[model samples]
Each structure stands twice: as structure tokens, then as C-alpha cells.
Target: MNRRDNAPGASADIGAALYGLATRAARRLPRDMSLTSAATLATLDRTGPRRITDLAAVEGITQPAMTTLVRVMEKSGLVERRGDASDKRVTLVCLTEAGASYVRTRRQAGVHAFERLISELTGDEVEALVAALPALKHLADLESQDREGQNQ
Candidate 1:
């Protein structure tokens, strides 16, 4: 039997709607940045400086690719490499002030887009989305935990 036929409680509809919402909101946002660069900047902002190998694992990209990305970001003055205090042989990728500001602007653009979308929604619709916030955060936490488990 098809999985959709199995239960009324399935999240297929929610998944599709959320995906649509996310895609539409993203499309409406004004930005000329690649997702990888945005995500990398956001990661460094969120997690602080980390080794390129660790960044590669977190981003699901190859180390060499991350090295290239870091090089480009460094050239752009978006990031910097530093010696690890505890390990002289290790290098850490850090977000420069410009990089952090860029991440902040990127995040604000997304928030502005979402806020506009929410303003167009009806009161009940907005309330439903507000109610769903906890569940969404829980899902995010689950994903993070799963990623951590994979690293271990």
C-alpha cells in the first residue's frame, strides 16, 4: 500500500506546504548570494570558528572544496584563518566583521520576507503558524541531534 494511504496523521501535506512557504519566501527575498556561502557564514556565526575539516563535515562538503571556499572568503575579506591556541598545527576558519555583518543582513532579509508573508495571512492562519513554532523548533533540534549522532 502507498504510504499516504496509511494514516490521516501523516505529515505529507504539512511538509509540502512548509516547503512551498519556504521556497516562496526565499524567492521573494532580495539577495544575490549563494546558499552555500550564506550557510557557511551562518554556521561560523552560530558555532564560532572551527577547523576546515569540521566545517566540511558540518556542511557535507569535501575538505578540499571547503578549503577553496575558505580561500575565496578570505580573499573577499569575509573570513580569516587563525592558529588554534591549543594546537599550533591546526588552522581555524573565522568570520571577519564583514562576514558576520553579511550574515546578519542575509538573516534580516529572510525575516523581512517572512514578515511580509505573515502580514498577508489571515489572523487564524497566522495563529496557526505561531502555534506551530514549537513543533518546528523541535524538528530543528531533532535534525541537529541526528547530525551529531552521525558525526559520532
Candidate 2:
């Protein structure tokens, strides 16, 4: 809405600021698992069961690495591999009840963290963030769409 918003480097500035905020916030949170494991769990929670290879592609990791991670998760009872109902030859990894619980707990923790941080902001700052939420959510939707397109 401001004149400077359309200036060169504005988008990058916004991106960097957002990334820095997220990185710092993430560092302050407890880490129960590696980011890859967390992301894999989130992916399953978001998009349902996925082939190991598809997960690997989505996470930008090697299939064998994904397999090892899946095996560990399975052993820990976080995830289970099941035969694809439509294709018996393929396997899909899905979240177990424990995994779903973990995802919900983790998401709640993130919400709490953000809420605490937001509580410290001035009234105007809080209003700005509240107003920006729809745009932020739209950004996330765009990214999700792009990722889904890639997977397809």
C-alpha cells in the first residue's frame, strides 16, 4: 500500500525478515526430532499417506534415506507402512495414532509460541499482524499448491 512497497528488493526484504523471524522462533522451541522427520510427519498429516519415493521427492532427499527414516519411525511407532489399497505392489507410509497425536501436540506448541510472542507486541503491531494473517495464509496456500503441482 505504501510507495516503497513496490520498490526493487522489497520482496526479498520481506522474505529475509520473515525467514529470520521464523528461524529465531524455531531455535527457541524444543527439538524432539530432526527437521526432516518433523517435515515427513507434517507431510503425512497434511496430505495423507504417501509413497516413500514421493515423500523423498517432496522432501528433496534420497529414496534410500527416506526408507531409513521411515524404518526408524516405524520402529518407534510413529509411522507405519501399509500396502496401497489400489495397488498391492506399492507401499504407502501413514501416520499412526501416536504420530497424529504428535503432530497435533507439535502444532499446538507452535501456536502457543506464536501467541506468546504476539502478546509482547504493541497494539498497532498486533493489529498489523492480525490484518496480515490472511495474506500470510494465502502465501502458504500458494506454496502448497506449487508443491502439489511438483508432486504431480
Candidate 3:
């Protein structure tokens, strides 16, 4: 049997293809917004309010850097810093209504672009992809868990 039949290489090739597709799709987004800022807003919108320290941890950035990012985002009306009701000293970062809308808009654009890209695929290929969605979600969860473990 030839080495070309190896499963690991095929899996790596699939991963690289997916990564390239995602990178290209991300490039289609608005140039005015940094990917980090967009990601932060989307995270806040999806997860609700979080402390600045926690947000920094989630975003894998330094606390001071996250502070600067929050300040800029706040000025752009994409995020708001509000004092926690239980502890007035603690500030919680939450997405503004406009931020939530912006996230939704960006998500829609990504979906549209992905759909258009896959429009040429055969029905069987589409069905295979749909069937793989659950496994893909599980893989994502596993990856997130690994990252959290490493952080701790």
C-alpha cells in the first residue's frame, strides 16, 4: 500500500482547507473593524455580561490591553461598562444594543458568504456536511475545553 493512503495526511489536508476557507471568509468582513474587536463584541453578545478580568481571560489578552480595547469599543457604541449591582466596585462589560445588531449582521454576512461558496457542491456532499455538523460542534467543544484546561 502507498503512503498516500494514510488517514492522518488526509485529515490534515481537510483541516488546512477548512482553515483557509475561514480565513478567506473573515477577510470579507468590513476593514474598519479589527477582528479582535468584532470577536470581543460577539462573545459579549452571546455570553451576556462579564467582568473585565474575565473578558480579558476569555479573549486571551492582557488586562491592560483589554481595558484599552473596551475603552475604544465603548466610544464606538459597541460595548458599555456598567457597575455590578451587587458590587458597585466591580465593572461588568456588556454589548450595547447596537453591538448585538452588529454581531448579527456580521454573522449573517459570514453565513451568506459560506453558503455561496458551497453552492456548487453536489447534493451528496451537502448532505454529508450536514450530517457532520454535530461532530463538528463536539470537536469545537473539546477544543474549548482543552484551552480552558491549559489556561488553568
Q: Please name the candidate that would achieve the greatest TM-score relative to the true structure.
A: 2
Sort every candidate by TM-score, greatest first.
2, 1, 3
- Candidate 2 per-residue lDDT over residues 36-128, each given as its tens digit: 998899999999999999999999899999999999999999999999989999999999999999989988998998898889999999999
lDDT of 1 by residue, 1-152 (tens): 87667777577787888799778866765566666767788889988999999888888889999999899889999999999999999999999999999889888978887787789999999999899899999987897788757755
lDDT of 2: 0.92
Q: Pairs clashing in candidate 3?
A: none
Query: Please, what is the TM-score per model?
Result: 0.86, 0.92, 0.85
Candidate 3 minimal-lDDT segment of 10 residues = 143-152
**Global CA lDDT of candidate 3, please?**
0.86
lDDT tens digits, residue span 1-152, model 3:
86657675876887898799779888889877888889788779767998878778877899999999999999999899899999999999989999999999999988888799679899999999999899789877887787657655
